[model samples]
Target: MQALQSRLQQLENATGSDIWNILKGSESDLIQDLSTLNTLKEDKEKKGREALKVLETKKKELKSLKKEIETLRNEYKLHVEEVEKGLKASGLEMSQVTKVFEKVLEDSLSEKKTKILQIISSMRDFKTIPELHSPLKSILELLKDPNQEKLRSMIQIDLEDIHRQSMEIFRQNLWSEFQKQGIPMKKLQETPNPDEFLQRVSRIFEFSSDLDLLLIGIPNNRIHVAFGMLSNICIDMIENEKERDADFEWILTSAHKWAKNLREVIEKATERTGSEFDEKFVEFIGNITKRFLKKNQKDPLIFTKLATLLRRFEDTCEFNLTDKDIFESLYEPEFISKWILLEIELFTLSFNQLLLDSSSFDPLPSIFIGSASSSTWASEITVQFEQWISRVEKDISSIRNPEVQTTFYECLYALMIDLCSKIHVEANRLYSEASWSNHVYLVMNTIWELRRIVKVFIFITNRERDRRGKKKDIELAGELKWPRENSFLKEN
Candidate 1:
């Protein structure tokens, strides 16, 4: 009994449980467990015997498969021998025939490869698409053979090269033809009739249309050269108008009309070729527009012209030319920084002119006293303020990016506040002189008029924004923050 209890304690320790309690329960339970273990041992031995039988059957089938494979190998050897005998009877060996056939195919492809390379090299010398027709057709014929798929792939690179060179040559020729016609000569100047200008422009269309028929079945052969040239001409004319001092309204209208004519000419060309006119023309115009903008970036008048140009394009043309498009083209960090600073220089000139004009004001009429009506000096400054707002709005209304527009508004607000601060400083200087009391009063009235104008400007702009269904986010900043606080300006 002591030995069995010691064994049961060992079992309890090994199992991590008090099995001795269950073991101490009944002898019938122990007898049933022993029966279940015996049954499981028998079942495992039976499964092992069945697995051995399945292994024996698999070994027999594998041995039979080896015999069948040997028979097949013998038959394959006999078939090869018969084929070799047949080749010998025809005065040909398998190895020799294969080498000869491979040589012929290789030589043929090499000759065609040389021809393609020659054609691509001489692409610039070729005058028309017809010059490319016979050689390209012959090379393409070999590409149609199913047996020559490898050969086709060998020349696919050359074919793409040809397409690129050909299109480049086409673009160059189109540009040359535009230059030849003197297309941009006086197109910038106002004319009673533009039909005569477009008539000369129609010559390039004829040239492109003649080649369009020949380029059928050729991939990536759409004629965009004319569109590109037209875009260049339009931009050049725009620059010309600016230099010629043409009317601003005319410049804006002419930009839209230029786009309209561009669309019409492109549509006419695509109709001949049965291809879709993509945004390539817009992109081309954008490139030229960037160059134009950069050239005139130092001139403040370009800003007003560019703004009005964008407005006219959006309002008139279905073509999507957004402010983002124009902004991105001119958005190089250094260029935009210089452009913004240029505005400061322009304002300084205009401000100096205003001061000069005010200096010349007769002392008799410039006299001021405390009254309900605004002083003459205040009236003149407010009128100038209204004009500045109008000019700024020309650019502001054209700015579509909300964040950029807000930044520009802040810039304008800062300029106004700076002007007020300067006036205040001058008033302080006047107050130092006891006889200049009326001058100080006039300057104070000017500040009050500026404040009134700011209020009216905010009200009108908010009403416009509300009508347009945009958020009324325009506001003022300073100690007397009327609409919103500008933390950036406050920091400055």
Candidate 2:
């Protein structure tokens, strides 16, 4: 319409006065069209008002209907409760009903009874079911027949008698086995070679004793007897070996191998040997440990022996076992795994004792233990530390054991055990976390370098590599882990 009006104006502008007169003549008709649109607008407003009133009336009806429905629902609920009460008063018990029977078979009592019996029969380890007694009593009472009171009493009496008789027989069998096999371990040292003796004892434990079952089973006197035998034998074999005391390395290596093998064999046996025997071999392990400690506690070289014994074992553990027969080697067939931790306990005790004995360290010159220079406590202990390392180097230099040479960690361990003892004492006495942090670092610095000093005697680590490379980088390998600067102040 706008386009038409614009075209008419363009015609008046181009064609002159006649087109302008015609456009003026159509203005009244345009006014009449606008008036007709206004009349239609009033009519639409009147119809919309009427529709809104009708919608409001319908909403009121819906609300009234909703109220009536809620009233009906409440009445239905009350009726359901009344019906349920009547049914319950007529001797119904929904609580006793099993969900399966109620849902699937419509609460069949016979089906529930069969299911309940299945549940009761499935329970094992009868002593564990004491908590179920009340429920069982309730179920039985529901199904009780007063007429069978005498029959039930008779069955209970018979069961009690049978249980008593069974237990008596079991006890007798245990005692009989104990009598035949629970004697002290026979002399395992017929041969000077310890391996054969170890094997013989292992055989006695395996075939005659059911040791795996015994270890998992109850421990009685027989178990103690077995442990006593193993302990006695282990300590004796090591302590009394021909020329073994002379060669400390050989004794340590043998101890390492035997302890590892024993632990392995015993672990494998106990893992799957789930027999119901009466006694555990772990207690025997404890006995072996006790005897070992008692026999060797007084030896001057006890700590070194204990340390060396475990050091070889620890070194062997660090290397990965790539061979398929590794387990077989450690836990060899028939020989029970020897307990290593027992010797480890002795080692720890010896170490702690060594730590507490300040006298073992050279006497510090007159001042406090923290100050060694100017005749202070520090100077004398440092002197002792040097002397101790010098002795260790001499000792390690004399090693004839090929195995000791082969495993260098054992050599390193030898250095650490004594070095750690000095540090342990000084750190506990002279330096603590609250007191003199820098001085603690000062003490630690000297202690750390002891390793480098010892390395010259037995350049066991990276010696070949350094020789092959032929460079000054060998110094890098020997550098001690110096204390970080944050905590330390060196005396100028």
Candidate 3:
């Protein structure tokens, strides 16, 4: 029995040893798995930190680029503004210079050649006006001479003096201003052309204005003095026959420049007053137009100036034809007859100028007639008719004089009828002459439009008359009823 118990104990010991081995194996595997998990976590954290560092660096670079772009935009804006201001100032300076140049030309032309040369030489170290008077007196005496050759030679010599004196004065004035402002006059003088000089002067002027209103303090007398100088130059140009072509081109170019300068000055003045000028503004324009007409009467450029003046006054002119008074003054039957004749005369003039073959009325009709599909002129005419209709309707209630009202209505009716008939005849002629192209179709369509406009005018007139007649009938009936009631009361 004891031997059997020892064998059973040995079997129990073997089973315990197997279980301990299995437990140790399980513990080792668990430790290995935990170590692998810890290593992976450490690697992940390190990579995340490195990626964050890279993002921060990229963000800072983007910010730097943004700031640089903003700085560049600001710098560019300032540069452009500076450039524009300079251009405006240069224009003003050139105007003043031109005026002074003109005066010099006039003085030179009026004086004797040797005397003028002496005066110019004296001006080299000019200290006083008295120093110039001796030479000036001598030149005045030479003007009494009647010899053409002597006169011509004397004038040429005087012109050279004038050019020299004018240039010296311009240079001195420009140099003084440049020095005071700390601008480089030498650089400006080195500029190749007038345009370049103008640009530089403009820039300087803009800078000056920004620094202070240095240009605004000039006296009224000074402005007139400048104008006088320019006037003298213009006279010289007109009188001098030797430099006709060169002078003409110069005058034209200078006049254009002067006009531009005047416009800029006016604009600046108005801007200072918040873009509103007084009645003096109108007077100023009128003065300019008068001067332009007087100076350039026969020049083709006069047409351009006249057209501009008309445009300026277009908004203010009494062009509405519906008001009885306006219609009577502008387009009564007598006036209409005169105007139509005048238009015909003008049309004939245009035809003569074109040297058109008028044997067939084709050219004449083409000029007056417009297309329907793309005719801007037709559109304008249509709008004008519409405006007349509106004005008639608006003024109908205010019309007091029966004769005047009748005159307006009749004039309007006649005008519309005449225009429509003319268009219809022209359209018919065109259709007969040619197969209907887009242009012919447009002409036919315009005739139809004119017919519609005339019909509308007739309808408006009839409707207005009917309304007034009904109101009159109501008033008449009330009067009759009152009289009948009064008679019954008296009888009782």
Candidate 4:
């Protein structure tokens, strides 16, 4: 057992006997664990290297993507700028083309007519030219050729033929339309007297003539044709006064239809694109006034017609008063003077007639006659005559030049003298009548006042003439002064 103990001690010394041997076994297990850990670390290092290679590849791809995106952005910006330049250039070209088109339309007459017709037809489809896709421009380009005129004239003739056919249908349809509206043909046919109906129809013709001349701007040639027809109708009516009233009514009805047709023709003429007919119409109106004067001679109808014409002139041309052409024509001195003289003559005739027949004198006639004869009776008439005289005086005063003023004054003086002579005759007739005895003192007193005022006016005018030393003015003054001076001396 001692020898066994010694062997065991040697074993213990070799491998740490007694629990040391078990510990040595555990240490071996730990060394094996360390070896396994070292193997795992080496495997982990290999995996790390693989992951680094993948990251490098991904980084290169990302850089390429960023460069591509930048290149694409630059290309897009350049494309947008080029598109904007193209749009601006196109807009400028369109504007230039439009201007060229308008010029062509204005200068080329044949082209204008053709294009206008086309435009009118197109208007049924579209409200405006723009909706027709630069139609005006295209039409203008087509019109640039010289053959457009011949084509236009041919087209016009064809259009007229078509219009004639269409108008027949239109008239028939219009008659039906009128019937549907319940307008009576019998009411339109009612006749007064043959002579009276002729006169009434003449008045309507005159109205239409004036309208055509002053308002519509019809050609002078057309005006002459229309006026001649109207004159013939008037002459026929006057010469055949014994004809049946129905005959006159039929003629008048025909005249109305003719006037309607003429108006339509004038309207069509005016629609021609470059036509300027307003001036011609004005000339035609003047001619009509002259013709009416010639037909009536010195009859009161002449003055009445002239007054009617003046009123029509005012209505038609007043809106264009500021237009230089219209103003010169309307305010011509000779025309105005003639009109004033006619007005004065009308007043004179009516005044003398009223004085001669007091039994038949109405209040209006008496008032007008009395006021015209003497300022003492001015209060008797309506304010209208007084305003008219005041306006006339203002118009006369507006003539600044001495020659015109003197001439106008002389004409007025003649009118005044003629008026005074008529008044004198009326006064003599009234004084001779025994029935006027009760009002005799009042009449004499008014006459005396008027005579005195007239004398005073003459004296003042003479004084002005003497101061001016104008021979014509002096002669007028002496003529007026002698009458009043002699009349006053004779009364005394």
Candidate 5:
């Protein structure tokens, strides 16, 4: 019993040193106590049984303590791991910067704002926008310390407010500067020296690039500001040009220059932001063209010039298009229909003027003594019809769309038939019986020439359709429901 008591005293002393360091020593002492308890178990004395029971109780207690120490150790390990993870996430390490940050947190709001502005200004030179947030994140981490909880809340709120106000003021100043640096599309157009205008454009591009770099902290700020400024400049130019009734060529050239240059800028601005400007630009152009079209619907040259300009713009800007689409897919079939009808109206007007200028179809009674072949003799109307057919062919050849060509050809066929009917009626009324046969030959000759012209146009139109892989039949004379005389020429 004295030996057991001695061992117990030793175990207690060992345990008192340090629980972590004494666990193994305490276990060794417990093992010796177990050996002594086993040796004393056979004594069969009351003190022996009591000693055995006491040893058993002590063993239970020590086992329980071991479990508790193990649980505490595991908990400590987890706590250390969590602290390491938090430090890593905060982009900070155990360093003296924490003490410095503590002092910064104690500064006045104005002083803090100044410091933040200085940090931001310095960080603006960072290679990437995301990298600029590193220093700010470190500041945030220092602010998150639980020791400065109240101070953290107050300072964070103040910093946020300061940042918001500063960003707004900064953005406005940058915007004002950007506006001043930007040369409007109208001014660029009016600039007679192409080299000077190009230099100004280069300067604008450089400014846009610098603005993008300066506004790195605000995501997409540069994109919005630059796009807005360009939008306003283009809109202003459109309004000014419309008011002045400027030539379509001028409007188109100016629009093209802006679009080509701004496209590259928009691409660069949106590249890092993962935002799209294509739809926005397309919508912008749609609106501007809509306004221009509304104002110049009566202008005869708008159709051809607008078509050429939009095709070039679409190609240069990488705008999507299908076979049936044109003008960056902005204008639809309805617009093309209007253009076709306008062209037919103009053709009719010109044809009417031609008739007015040379009203007589018969040969004048001029005494020409030169002998001529009677078979080769042709009326002035036949010559006029041939010349008119050549002009019509030239105009139609300039049209690229096969469907539009087919539609125009059909309308023109109807027009020719109506005009021929009138010519037949007029000839019957004016010619005497003696000249009736000659007049008939001359009229038939004109009809024959018109028939040849119609065949040639059909062949050309069908060949175009075949080239486009369209199998739809276009019977210009027979299949089409021809409009009444002069009815198709009316405004829709």
Candidate 6:
């Protein structure tokens, strides 16, 4: 707007000048009016000729003043032209900038005011504006101070500082304000939220697309700052949204999609410097593992979820496939492999407790005499297994190597054996026919259920072995101790 006003004023000053038109015919007008003096008597025409002479002098002064103003106007026009070109080169849309500036600086505007307003016009769409130091500085430097440098100095802006402030504002405030129409307040950070989360999340990616289109050629130092700012904001927002009652793994899985959007923006903005940006998120992953580990010191099912969480990072973060596995996995392959190894250990530990619990090994006919309410021990164990294994199967999609998959299956096989052995011991201890049939039915049912689950471990491990061309000399079910029909006390 300021630019248009400046331009309109410039066009008016250039074309609406009657002084230039008068100057172009001044000599003829002066000659025609003074010609009567040549025909008159010398004494009588002298005063008229002197009056004409004085009028001609004033006209010459006006002409000189007009020329000087024209020169300044021409200089200002050249400056505006150059700035518009710079805007185009910088990938900023001049048409949009013009419209935006026209609306913003409509009242207080000048040709010199157009440049920064053009850069800042992007504010309507996003909080963060592209780096404006170069274009703004260049344009300001080109401008001639209208108030003898007083007003110019007062209005002098540090575009870098403004850029920083805009980004910080975004970081400090939650994005929910912009997304009020999106995720319902009741559903925020809750389950059945992926769909809503995705709607808001897609905007970040779309925001990324806009950043990629920026004509901003900020310095490498500025690029680093951008990446750092964005990375920190991502970590902070995702962390701040931690919902205590919601599923931990589910929140992280959803959070990772947003993080990936930030990552893509940083990668695009930083280019060669993206490694530093990419590595920063590794710290977030490491922190999640540490937090989960501290919380799971006594919880049995957490390791499976923890392992799953780490595996999610490994898949999305681009950890290498050939590297040796570790107890810590992340964007860093070494650490990621290490994390995976730790998860496998935790997985093994959890199952060992699940399957080898001595309480399940009690073998007595008295176990059948208790009311249905009194003997919920086996049902409780089965319920826990059902809740756990379903989650385990669903969340470990990040496991890349076939060997790692086999290790987990082997652990499951071992667990199946431990559980089956305990049930077998209990089944052999029943005395009377009614008690034996009743308790034995329960024990055999437990064994068969475990066997069916072991079959999955069998199918996975055997298939993996085939893919690797390993000798299929061993059977998964045989190793897991499939219940052979050796009658315990001849079913008596």
Could you tell me every candidate's TM-score relative to the true structure?
A: 0.52, 0.25, 0.23, 0.29, 0.43, 0.36
What lDDT score goes with residue 129 in model 5?
A: 25
Q: Which tens-of-lDDT digit does each residue in 42-85 have in candidate 4?
A: 99998999999999999999999999999999989888677667
Ranking by TM-score: 1, 5, 6, 4, 2, 3
Question: lDDT: which candidate is best?
Answer: 1
In terms of TM-score, which candidate is stronger, 2 or 3? Answer: 2
Worst 10 residues of 1 by lDDT: 479-488
Say which candidate scores most in TM-score. 1
lDDT of 5 by residue, 134-240 (tens): 55554544444444445444455545543454444444544554344353333433435545545544443343443333322444444455456666665666667
Which segments of candidate 6 are over 4 A away from where they belong? Answer: 1-300, 306-390, 395-397, 401-407, 431-434, 468-476, 479-492
Expressed as tens digits, the lDDT of each residue in 231-326 for candidate 3 is 444456555535323344344345334433433432332233221222223333333334434445444333333433343343344222232221
Backbone clashes in model 1, listed as residue pairs: none
What does candidate 1 score in Cα RMSD to the true structure? 16.1
Residue-pair clash count for candidate 5: 0
RMSD of each: 16.1, 21.8, 27.4, 31.0, 25.7, 29.2
**lDDT at 405 for candidate 6?**
54
lDDT of 2 at 374: 30
Q: Candidate 1, residues 1-492: lDDT per residue as tens digits?
A: 344455566575554345655456545656666678788989999999999999999999999999999999999999989988999999889899789988997888777667656655665466565575555555555455444556546666766666565556566754664455443232323333445544544544543343343232453333456556655665666566655434534544555555454455444434443323335535554576576676666566776676666566556655554333544454556555665676666766766566545332123355442354644444566666667777776676665555566556667767776665545445555667776657655655555556666776677666756765654564552312211122213333
lDDT of 4: 0.45
Error (Å) of candidate 6 at residue 6 is: 88
lDDT per model vs. reference: 0.57, 0.43, 0.44, 0.45, 0.54, 0.48
Model 6 lDDT per residue over 1-492, tens place:
333344445456555465465445455655654665555667667888999999999999999999999999999999988888898899777688889876654434444455545555644345432343244344445343444244244334634444455445433322442234222222333435445545544444333333332224433333333334434443454455545323656545554554554444334433333444444445455555454454443454445556665666556555233343322442245433454456456555654675455334333333232247633233434554545555655544345455555555555555555544554555555433456666556555555444455566456546656766642444434432323356432222
| lDDT string, candidate 2, 1-492, tens digits | 454475567575555676776667666765766777788988999999999999999999999999999999999999978866876898765454345345554334445455445534543233322333343444344334333343234344433343333333333443333233322221223224445444534433333232222122323322334334345555666567555345544533544344334334333333332221112332333333344444554554543453454345435542232322111211221211121233334345654565565443433445342324432333344454445445444333333333333333343354455445445446555554565566555555455444444454336434633543422223322333333343222221
TM-score, cand. 4:
0.29
